[model samples]
Target: MIRTLYIDEMNTLHVCDSPYDIEVTPKWLWVDMSEPTKEENLLLSQFFHFHPLSIEDATTVKQRPKYKEYDDYLFFVFHAIDLRTMKPEEIDIFINSTLIVTYHKEASEEVDKVWHTMLNKKPNEKVTTNEVMYKTLDAIVDNYFPFVYDLEDKVFSFEDRHSVDISTENLIDETFDLREDLLLIRRTVLPMRDLVYRLLEGKVLALSKKQKIFLHHINDHLIKQVEMIESSREMTADIRDNYISLNSFRMNNIMKILTIYSVIFMPLTLIAGIYGMNFDVMPELHWKYGYLAVWIVMIAITVGMIGYFRIKKWF
Candidate 1:
């Protein structure tokens, strides 16, 4: 579907299903194409004459977040995340002095919102393609916050559980899943942050001071998001390490106890082995008091070993 929003010379807002339906020269024009068909996609070449590479990138479903500056316009491959699944929704943008075109394979809530706001403008309010573009970008960035904060809260909760509940089931799996989610969010946010940085540093947009400020504010949000992602990633790593370390410590304690038992039993086993041997050299086997003497010897050995172990604190 293709929706067009344009402002006439009288600064009145108008909406049309097709850009060709608008007769007057618009002060600013916005063309939003949502899942356009092949014929509708031709508007890129027949109407706007965008570069083939930019058109291809725009039509494609998944492109990394980036912006390319052409001779007359700038093309951007932006992503809005699916908050429920943490997947990216690609939204391509083409912007020049008087026109802004948004092409997306899927319907965009952010785009719809900006479109609505443009349509419902105050009588005296002025709108431009740049302002519309900024609003869309801002809306996309704002959408990220809820997902980020939710992930952060989960990470915090998982960390707390890990601290107090050592036997919690699937702890490692949960940690890894959280890390994976953070990684996905980071993939979208990092490139977006770079794209915004490039927009701010370069003169491609010809933005007003206020617009630049607005973009800067978006950049700040992106920075905070990146920081949050990194911090969460670190927390997950710490959790994994702590879990492994705790298991190792428990294993060492178990091995220590087993070793102490083996040490105490070694002499008793040796004494029993000698008596079990039937040979001519076993003279004590026939003595009347031999069994008693053997019992006393074994008991003495056991008591002596226990005393030595206690002195050294081996147990």
Candidate 2:
């Protein structure tokens, strides 16, 4: 669907269903296309005369976070993340001195919020394309905090031995999954950081002094996000290594016990083997007290070895 927000010279706000509904030249105009149909997509080329490449990029989803300078307007591609799935939703923006256009394949809470704020502005309160862009970008970046904070909390929980009650295998699996989520968030954040930094450089977009400050604030947020993600990823690695080491330690203890038992049985097995041999080794078998004597010797050997192992604390 296509929607338009137009502000007049008197600082009046007008919301329209289509661009054609705006009869007068707007001081500031914003057009939003959400899940646009093929016919609505053509508005970019036929009505607004956007470059075909820019149009294609806007229509397409999953474009990396970036911006391109055009002769008349600056084009930007940004990602709005789904916190639950850690998936990115693309929001494409076209902005000039007076007009801003936003396109997305799905509904955008960020866009909707700024859109409503613009609509509800008090009388004589002027809204500019720059303000709208900043607000939208701010909202997008702000949404990232909850997910990152949640990831950090989970990592902390993993580090606390008393907090995590699951098996080592399951804990490791969860840590790996958290790492993957951080990677996903990183992919979205790093490009966004670069995009905001470039915007701050002002080589393309001619930002005013105040605008630069606001954009710089957003850049700061992106930097904070990047740091948090990196720290969380490292924590996940530590958690995984700790669990693996614990598993190895447990396995070594088990193998030690099995080896001690094997050593204790080795001599007994040898004596039994000799006595079970045929005629040539059968002198003890014919002795009147031979069975009892052999039993005594075997018991003594077993007891003595056990005592030696206990003294050495081998168990």
Candidate 3:
């Protein structure tokens, strides 16, 4: 999908399909493309003079988060977190004097919302492209908190439900999965955070006063997002440790029970072994009264052992 916006005035912006060009004032124009093809790439390169290396990275999926300063533009690659599954999708953004291009391997809900907000109004009622960019970045950052909060919630849920029946394997896997997602989010957010920080710090030459103010707003949002990601990562680590401790406790309890059972039965086993031995000269085997005496003795021994175990609190 490709969306092009040409902003001429505050309320009047033009929306067009991709693979097309128009000459407008040195105003803010934003173009977004997803899963571009060879023909689309060729068209963009012809019109924008985008660097070959930047185009290569844009075309390839799963590029790492980075920033490349070209002669006339800034190329940035970042990932958007998928809140439902805690995965990251790579997104590429390029900015020059009058044009901003965004490339993505998959659809971003935040991007789509920003695009619609830009195009829904008449040209005279549209917002500045810079402001639109701010909103786009803001939306992406805004989404991060919800995902991080959800991960935190999951960690707490796991900790609260710790039990012997719960499978440690699954819990550990989930903790690692949450941690991986937080790391991916951090990779994207941290660089973008730095970029916004530079803008807030007045380091970028491309931004005008109005654009800088808008970028500063985006910077604040990014800062919060990065903090949330970091906090969530820590929460996952804590949950993992809790799971380990719970499992160890359960194992120790099981071993204690088995050991106590073995100890309690040792004396009974010894007495039974002695009686079962075959000996023709055993005097008790031929006496009728002796059989009764042996039964009484066995009962007495069993009761004594039970009382001793009770007194020792071994149960």
Candidate 4:
């Protein structure tokens, strides 16, 4: 679907569902091509001097987060995350002086946000394409905040509740999952920060001073998000390490008790071995009370070793 919004020089708002129905004027314009068909792609290609590679990138799904500068326009592939599943969503944009176009495979709340803003925003005298582009990217970044905070909350909750009487295996599994999510979010955010940096340094779009400052502010926010994600990742790592260490400690205790049992039984087993040897000349074998005496000695050895272990607190 193609949706076009045109703001006249007087900042009048005009909304059109069909791009052909709306006539382009000499004013700042924002064109949104959502889940565009082949015809829509060709139409957008005609409207702007979009390089073939840029057009392909725009149409392509699952593109990595990146920014490409062309002779006439700046192209961006940005990723947003799903809070529920922690998957990445790609949003592609083409920005130039007079127009801005966004393409996505699925319907995006992020694009709708910018659309609503451009429609509802009261531009007093004039609105520039840079402003619209900034709004577009800014909305995408804004949507990221919720997912970031949700991830942080989950990590923090896991950290606080890890000591609860839950299954240690489950704890480890959850922490690993959270780490994967943090890594995924980081993958999206860091590149977006780089994209913003490239935008700030590049000559395309001709960002005005006001627009640059606005973008810088957004860039700073992205940096903070990256930091939060890193911190969450560390938390997950710490949880995993703690779980491993605890298991190792438990295993050591088990081995210690087993070793103590072996040490206590060695002498008793040796005594029994001597008595069990079949020799007709053995004096103990001939004694009538020899069997009773051997039983008594084994009993005493077992009791003595158990008492010793208790005293030493070997457990």
Go through the candidates in order and give the C-alpha RMSD of each one to the true structure. 2.0, 2.2, 4.4, 2.6
lDDT of 3: 0.74
lDDT of 3 by residue, 1-315 (tens): 676877664435667776365455536778888767777777558888888988888886557666788998888776677767667777787876567888886788888988887767654553554565567777877777777677668766865666653678888888898788778667777877876676566555567777777777777778777777777777788888877888898899899778876765677678778778998888877887986887777778768877887898866
Better of 1 and 3 by TM-score: 1
lDDT of 4 by residue, 1-315 (tens): 888887766667788876567665636667788878887778757867588888877776468878778887778888876556667788888877777788887788777876776677765656666776677678778778888898889877876687674688888888888888788778888988888888788775566778889999989889888888888888778879999899899899999989988988898899989988888899989899999998899889989989988998886
**By TM-score, who's the top model here?**
1
The local distance difference test score of each candidate is 0.89, 0.89, 0.74, 0.80
TM-score of 4: 0.88
lDDT value, candidate 2, whole model = 0.89
- Compared with the true structure, model 2 gives a TM-score of 0.91
Least accurate 10 contiguous residues by lDDT in model 2: 157-166
Candidate 3 positional error at 315, Å: 2.8
Instruction: Write candidate 2's Cα lDDT for 147-225 as tens digits.
Output: 9999899888875762657588788888888899899899999999998987787577667789888998999999999
Tens-digit lDDT track of model 1 for 23-46: 999988999999899999999999
Q: Looking at model 4, which ten-residue stretch has the lowest summed lDDT?
A: 18-27
TM-score of each model, in listed order: 0.92, 0.91, 0.74, 0.88
